[model samples]
Target chain A: DVKVTQSSRYLVKRTGEKVFLECVQDMDHENMFWYRQDPGLGLRLIYFSYDVKMKEKGDIPEGYSVSREKKERFSLILESASTNQTSMYLCASSFASGSTDTQYFGPGTRLTVL
Target chain B: AQTVTQSQPEMSVQEAETVTLSCTYDTSENNYYLFWYKQPPSRQMILVIRQEAYKQQNATENRFSVNFQKAAKSFSLKISDSQLGDTAMYFCAFMKHYITGTASKLTFGTGTRLQVTL
Candidate 1:
């Protein structure tokens, strides 16, 4: 089974604080993605890494950055957290463009910025 | 940019009943993949079913199936004999098919909240 685990299931932070969300996958997938889920907008991609040290900005990349130092781990960083940044963050992993086209998602982290 | 639209915001059905959720996408690419993802309360999201655009036959997984219309750029999910466990947020997603190593990003609909009541 492909297991994608997030560091925290819930988080609380103050405004202007730096936050980090970690994700790890056991399937050795080459693609890792970070997405934020909002009520009306659904899940919007923040960033994705295709390989180690290679990252690409998704539709909503502002105020966020990602790190992929290794194949199994991907990290999402919030430079300056704001109240509007409070949303459910989800991590996903998938095999590099192959027969397996589906992405396995981690239990999301709901962050609250006060 | 590809856009996926799920016009239904919420839906309810009794147990043992059937429900179909609608999804429409705007894209120019002919070769791509469409997916239905289910996210239950407090649990991680999971792929319910996926249909490749090039494949004429609809993809089915047990009680879950999809109606894919390539020309119309529409894809919908139908759950037969809906159960309580089927209650969740259903999101329709699109991803361009690629043979290379880099996987394409998935564009998702706003999601339809489904409730399977007694």
Candidate 2:
């Protein structure tokens, strides 16, 4: 079975603080994604990487950046945390092949910004 | 641009019963994929079922199945003999890829909250 592990299950940060969310996958998938999930908005993509050091912006990438220094790890960085950035963060990994590749998701990190 | 829609916000079903969740999507491409993902209280998203737009027959996984209507651009999930563990927030997703065979992306729906009761 494919597993995607997130570093934190829950986090709390003050406004204007820097925050990092780490994600790792054991499957060595070529594609990794970061998404923030809100109550009524569902899950919106933040950023995605197809290979190491290659990243692309998704639907809502403002105020967020991502790092993929290695194939197994992907990190989401908030330049400066704000109350609006408080939400559940999810990481997913998948094979960067045809359109049919199903993404495997990690247990999300619920971040709270105060 | 492609967009997915889940109109039902909440649904309830008694244990050992059946329930259906509706999803619709708009896309100009003829080939694409649809998926039903379940997120439990633990916040872990699980792939429940998937259907390819090119396939005419519906897709099924154990007790979970999808009713895919290509003409209407609708894909609905049906859970039979609902179990307590089936209670979760179900999201419908659409996926398309670049011609290079890389850069596959997913567009998600608003999700439907499903509750199972006795």
Candidate 3:
């Protein structure tokens, strides 16, 4: 079984603070992704990394960035945390090959910005 | 761009019964993939079932199955003998086939929240 673990399950930060959400996968998958999930809007992609040091912006990448220094770890960074950034964040990883590969997800981190 | 739609916001069913969740997607790509994901209260989202656009046969996993219609671009999930553990938010996602280097991003629908009752 594939295991994806996040650094924090819940976090609270003040406005204008910097926040980091970390994700690690044990399956050695080459593709990792960061997504923000909000009520009635579902999950929207924030950023994704295909390989080490290679990152791509997804649908909603504003005010957020990602780091993939190693294959197992992917980190999401918020330049300046705002109240609007409070939401559940999810990390997923999958094989680099075909679309049929399943993207295993980590238990999400619910961030609260006050 | 692809868009997935799940019109049902909330649904309820009794335990040991069957329930179906509807999903529709708009996309021009002929070859793509569709998925149903279940997120429990624990917040760990897991894949329920998947269907390939080119395949005529619907995909099934244990008690979970999908009704895929290519022409209408509809994909719905049917769960038989629903249990209390089946209560969760179900999301329908669409992914277009891409080249090797590009990572496929999923376009998800606003999920349907299912509640199982006695």
Q: What lDDT does candidate 1 reach at residue B83?
A: 99
> A62-101 in candidate 3: lDDT tens per residue?
9999999999999999999999999999999999878556
Candidate 1 Cα outliers beyond 4 Å, as residue runs: B99-101
By how many angstroms RMSD does model 3 differ from the true structure?
A: 0.8
Chain B TM-score by candidate, in order shown: 0.97, 0.96, 0.97
List residue ranges in candidate 2 displaced over 4 A.
none
Each prediction's TM-score against the native? Answer: 0.98, 0.97, 0.98
Chain A only: TM-score of every candidate? 0.97, 0.97, 0.98
Clashing pairs in 3: none
Q: lDDT tens digits, residues B49-87, model 3?
A: 988888999999999999999999999999999999999
* Error at A3, model 3, angstroms: 0.6
Classify candidate 3 by CAPRI docking class.
high
lDDT tens digits, residue span B26-87, model 1: 99898899999999988889999999888999999999999999999999999999999999
- In order, what DockQ does each candidate have? 0.74, 0.65, 0.80
Worst 10 residues of 2 chain A by lDDT: A94-103
| Candidate 2's TM-score | 0.97
